[model samples]
Target: MNNILTLAAIYRQSLFYFAIRAMTILEPQTKLSRNWHQKAIAYQLMQCFLGLCRRLIINQPPKTLKTHLVSISYVAWLLMHDPSLRIAIICYDEALASTQLRKIRQLLRSKWYMALAPATRIRKDKDTETLFETTAGGEVRALSVQGGITGHGFDVIIIDDPQKASLAHSETERRHLEELYASAIANRWRNPAKGVLIVVMQRLHVDDFTAYLLRLRKDTVHLNIPAVAPVDMTFHLDDDEVYRFREGELLEPERLSDVVLEELRTAQGEVHFQAQYMQAPVKTGGCPINPAWFRTYTELPKYDYRIISIDPAFTENGGDFSAALVCDVVGDDVYLVHGEQVQCDYPNLLRWIETLDKTWKPDLFLIEAIGAGKGIWGLLRERDFHHVGTIETHNGLPKLRRMEIVSPMIEAGRVFVPANAEWARQFLRLIGSFPYGPSDDWPDALSQLLIRLRDACMRAGQHRCRRFPPDPPPQQTSLRYGMHYRKYWL
Candidate 1:
């Protein structure tokens, strides 16, 4: 045994060679770089982005933490290059969209990004199109997502993230978002060379807009760089639980964690996730007044209403959606039961409304006598709505005053919405979108309907007008000194 003296003595003396071999298999540098333990690729991308922003004022992208930097960087990158891009980044919620904008501002203010500027350099030549003015005679500007955002003929269309707070599973919400894009965002692009649409988003659901685009823009490049990269670069894991091989496979409910899972299973679950990350075409979130509030999610008996409210927009392109809201007077409350948002030529809208009326079987039709709505109203008057017999006509009210009248009803939780995310989003966002500017069409139309209804109710002594009820029949017939007084009444 002693004579054999295993490699314990001789080989032990060459332990350094074994150590070197081990180093080859597990290198510290590789772990630090590849293991995400040190400055990983994500960090480098950040560095390059910050480097680009450090000096240019307009170049300074919004500064979000490492978590949100990816999407933020993409938007910042676009804004820095060309400021004329009038984009409607439709998201599920106003809070989230506003947050994104603020973050972009924060990135610009970061010490790292601000350093790119020359000491004596200053921004100049500022206008809507020329957003940024480099210290060396340059400028930058912005285009809002509201009414005037269109007609910019933007050279670039960056859809960093659309939709507000959303659920992936809600069908109603999904439809509303599709409407926004088809009606609003689609018209915004008039440039012949129409700038490329750059979208960066997380996977929300199967039918989410991301998936929609995956199918829609088959020719365009799709780049999805998630938080983590797994083995087999060609295929990636979706979240933690599910394996996604197909380009458009949505992250399933079981794959996500419990919190998100909870949101997934609820009535709002599908709508929320779909809009939040999956980029599902969804209505705006926080819509205190959702069209769904007027609808039945489950099969139930619906009673006929005295009138059906409809508001329509005019113009061939760059027009608001034509809306048809159905309501019945129940006691003092107006039960708005169902509605539709249509974008069609004049004839088509009239035809469709008549068809919808037949299907819904409402008692009568009440339409806004303004703009495109007047066309439908006129058409309905000429053709007769299915010869149902009843017809009521009304004009739009002051937009702001109308909203003020309805706000109380929303705050009191009296108005029921079908839980539409995009509708709610546009409803809420539009109110605050412009201090003194145009708004999302649905809200304006909705306000008009409520105002018209309230007026009708007030005249009938049914609904107490939220804003101004008629002064009680000149109660007491007050006769002031020197004032004209009727001989008998006074």
Candidate 2:
């Protein structure tokens, strides 16, 4: 009886202990892999259960037992401590939610768990695959982000991977999730002030649901544990305990060795690996346009040709800004001499364009013939800027494809940016972040300039400069270079 009581005491005190025992009960044949990262996760979950932290966000790599620690063991442990505490488990889909809830139900029904939490008995009358209630009024419910929880309320809400990784790029899906949280899920808390909300998932996109929550709530305790440590760091687990990881250290080297991680990185592109494994969606290491590929120039060389490219926003009050880049092409090398983005009205935009044209005295001015570009083109033409031309629409290629077309120029060590300019730093960041980054105006302008340069070189019968992929087949519209400019076709 004394040993039984001591075991119970240890289980109650340490979530790590409880988890290990529960894992044994759940997977009797499988051997357990012990790691400090697991202990760190368990500690954070314990803090959430104890109400020490009401809002918790856990971002980690896949297959790290995030679901086991958070959705399964944590739910069972919560019921053990307080039989009357209501809980809800949310997942990306209904099937996933049901599976997680079923696991928790299995734990609650296990003989080992019964011996530990004698008071928490599952009520047979209300038992289902997705939901089950304890006799003491405590209930566990499974919900999906798409499913309705109109009348349901819970003391604790655990959302596991609210969005699927495949659908992470869909702005519509992302917006729907944000709206759902604001309108529904957030308000379902039984106790507004006391209810705990825990979100656990791998990072998918720069503006994913995790990012949304972080932006919305200031007090959220974000525990971002990357698969490999990017730098040496120390984590305070408790007053007496701290876990330290050296730079380039694996989170769990035994389970996920350096060899395995490299294979995964190769199989999955750098962008996916960085977001899912490193928890860095917009890091330059993941981007197709690598920062290392760009050569920085301190002194300008005599340029054979100079041109200014512009990507304009529709309105001053809009999210996007009017971006312009002054690019100088000397033989095979394209140098980014100057770049700027600003939120301004048409008059201001026109003035900015005129200023850039006057300052650079480029041979040609290329403006994307969309939104504010059309107005800017008309205004520039009226101002007697004869060198100006509009970049023809109807390319049928997306922004990403356009960037990909010009990436070869950058990778070939032919692209240059000013070494010490502040705008250059911002330009590199914008391009490096690419499709995941907040703004693609700079990338757009840069790609346009590169495309134009490539097309001009090809037209001039310079086969050496034809390194990039051929332009897409021409559409219905073909116009003169100075009037309504279109990409030159062979």
Q: Model 1 Cα RMSD, Å?
A: 18.8
Query: Cα lDDT of model 1 overall?
Result: 0.42
lDDT, candidate 1, 1-490, per-residue tens: 6743453343223222222222233333532111221122233233323332111101111111222433344444434443333333333444454555445445444443343211312234332221433343322223333322333443334443443322333555557656666665555544534344444445554565566665655554443433222222332112122333345332232334446444433423333333333333354333333333332223223432334666666534656677666655443455555656777777777677778776766555556554555556556656644322222332223444345445544444445544444554444455455224354565655666565555555565543433233342343222222222121110
Summing lDDT over every window of 10 consecutive residues in candidate 2, give the lowest-scoring window.
476-485
Where does model 2 exceed 4 Å of error?
283-490
Give the backbone clash total of model 2: 0
Give the Å error, residue 68, model 1.
Answer: 3.6
* Top-lDDT candidate index: 2
Reference-based TM-score of each model: 0.32, 0.61
